[model samples]
Target chain A: GIQVEQSPPDLILQEGANSTLRCNFSDSVNNLQWFHQNPWGQLINLFYIPSGTKQNGRLSATTVATERYSLLYISSSQTTDSGVYFCAVPGGAGANSKLTFGKGITLSVRP
Target chain B: DVKVTQSSRYLVKRTGEKVFLECVQDMDHENMFWYRQDPGLGLRLIYFSYDVKMKEKGDIPEGYSVSREKKERFSLILESASTNQTSMYLCASRVMGGGFPEAFFGQGTRLTVV
Candidate 1:
């Protein structure tokens, strides 16, 4: 079983600020995904970066597969960003690729 | 648009009741999964099916059973629902392809066993 660890379990930020959330995995991964669970409990896909870097609006993510670590960056965060950010990786490097998720980072953006 | 739809958004049942959670994906994905999320446990996989009539146990599969009779539908069944089973359940479906498969999730169903 591969372990996924997320840093800064709890986070609070003022609006218009910036933040970075990190995820580290115990073993190699075939895929890595970043998800945002909103207050309504809908998991929104943020990024599908197994490696390299990608940006979507104010949100960007980078996964260094060689280092077994990934970073999610939010720039000029707004109150809508208040929720839980979760990072999930494949449970194994094989073909099945069962996703194992971290405990998640709780983010609070004050308006 | 690609969507995964769960049968219910909220449910309440008594202990020992048989509960069924249904998930359907419009994308015709080959991989479907069921996961339960607790306060501190994140999202633990209960079961996943990669194809029709096939199933595999996940990290926390005790007391949970799944059925994938059709390619578009996957069901999670609880033989006898217990209080400990009360939590948010999420259903996801992913297209089986090369290296870039991304999972799409349903609006979670929050169930409580009384």
Candidate 2:
């Protein structure tokens, strides 16, 4: 089993501001993913970066697999970005690839 | 577009009652998963299936069971519900292979065991 810890449990930002969220894992992982739980409670897949970096519009993520850490970046934050961001890492192998998630970072973007 | 649909968005059950949560996917994915999300603990996997009739235990499977009778459907069952079982249940599906398989999730079912 792996332990995941997320930093800055809570964050508040004004419109057009930027922020970064981090996740650190205790063991090596073959999978790492970032998800955004919108106000409506829909878990949206933001990034699946096990390593390297990826960007999608205003959101980007980087995972340094060697260091067992990942970062999620939100640029020009908007009110719509206000929600909880979660980072997950899966351990074990084969069909039972279970994901262990962090406590999550709650973001509040004031308009 | 891939769609994961959960049978119920909200449900209430009495203690010791049997409960079933159904999930269906339209993309013909080879892998399906069930997870329960709780405060502070985030999401914990309950069970997952790789193929029809095949199942595996996850981190937290003590109170949950899953069934995949068909390729497109995965069901999570609670033999006897308890008050502690109250949480938001999410279903997800993903491909077996390829680079960084992204799991498409359902809208989630908020269950309360009273």
Candidate 3:
């Protein structure tokens, strides 16, 4: 089983601010995804970056597979971005492709 | 639009009651998963099915069972619910091919066992 850890268990940012959230895995990961759980409990897929970099709107993510780390950057954060950000990695490098999620980072963006 | 729909948004049951959580995906995905989210524990996998009539145990599968009778539907069953089983349950579906296979999740079902 691979362990995924997310930094800054809780974070608060002002509107128009930029922040970076990090995820570190205990082992190599073949599949990794970032999710945001809104206040209403809808888990939204933010990114599916196993490697390289991807940008969606003001949110971007980069995964360095060799280093077993990933980073999510949010630029000019807004109140709608407030939620719990979770990072999940599949078990081992080549397994059943089931995701093991981290404890999640709670984000609150104040406007 | 691709969607995963859960049967209920909230539920309350007494201990020893049998509970069923249903999930349906319209995207025709190859993978369906059931996970329970608890405070400080993140989301713990309870069960997942990659195909109809097939099942696999996840990290925390005790006191839980699953059925995938049809390709579009997956069900999570609790034969006898306990107080500790009260938590938020999420259903997700993903395709087999594609980059990393992003999961589409349903708005979670919050259950409480009295």
Candidate 4:
């Protein structure tokens, strides 16, 4: 099984600040995804980047598959971004590969 | 848009009581999964189904069971609920593909066992 590790288990940022969250995987992965669990406990899909870079509004993500690492960037952070950010990847190969998630980074954006 | 709907937002149950959490997807995805999220443990997979009438056990499936009678619906069953089983349960659905596809999650069902 592949292990996913997220850095800075807890983070706090001021409104309009920028921050980066990282995720490192122990083994090669065919699929990688970023998720945001809001204060209400709803898990929202952020990005599905197995490799390369993607940008969505003020949020961007880059996955260096060769390095077995991924980085999520948030710019001009807002109070609404206060929640848990998670990284997930399929545990193994084949169609039955289930996603294994990291503990998550708890982000607090002060207004 | 992909929509995953959980039957309940919150539930309270007693020990030894049988409980069922229902999930339905509108996108007709082939893969459906059940996961439990704790305070610091993140999301742990409990069970998953790749197709109707097919199922697979996940990392933490000892106290849980699942059913996939129809392509659009998946159910998680707890035979005898216990306090330790109380947590937020999430249901997700993803399309069947060779590469990693995006999974859409439901709002989650918070269950408390007493």
Candidate 4 chain B weakest lDDT stretch, 10 residues: B95-104
Q: What are the per-residue Cα lDDT tens digits for candidate 2 across B1-114?
A: 999999999999999999999999999898899999898888888998988999989888998888899999999999999999999999999877634367889999999999
Clashes of each: 0, 0, 0, 0
Candidate 4 fnat reads 0.79
The better candidate by TM-score, 3 or 4, is: 4
Worst 10 residues of 1 chain A by lDDT: A90-99
DockQ of 4: 0.82
Per-residue alpha-carbon lDDT of model 3 for A1-111, expressed as tens digits? Answer: 788899999999999999999999999777689999999898998998889999999999999999999999999999999999999987644334787899999999999
Local distance difference test, each candidate: 0.93, 0.89, 0.92, 0.94
Model 1, residue A19: distance off in Å is: 0.3
Model 1 per-residue lDDT tens digits across residues A70-107: 99999999999999999998776555577889999999
Two-chain DockQ for each candidate model = 0.67, 0.55, 0.60, 0.82
Clashing pairs for predicted structure model 3, backbone only: none
Candidate 3 chain B weakest ten by summed lDDT:
B94-103
Residue A57 of candidate 1: its Cα lDDT?
A: 98
What is residue B52's positional error in candidate 4, in angstroms?
Answer: 1.0
Q: At residue A92, give the lDDT of candidate 1.
A: 64
Q: Which digits, one per residue and each the tens of the lDDT, describe model 3 over residues B1-111?
A: 789999999999999999999999999998999999999999999999988998899989999999999999999999999999999999999876534477899999999
DockQ: which candidate is best? 4
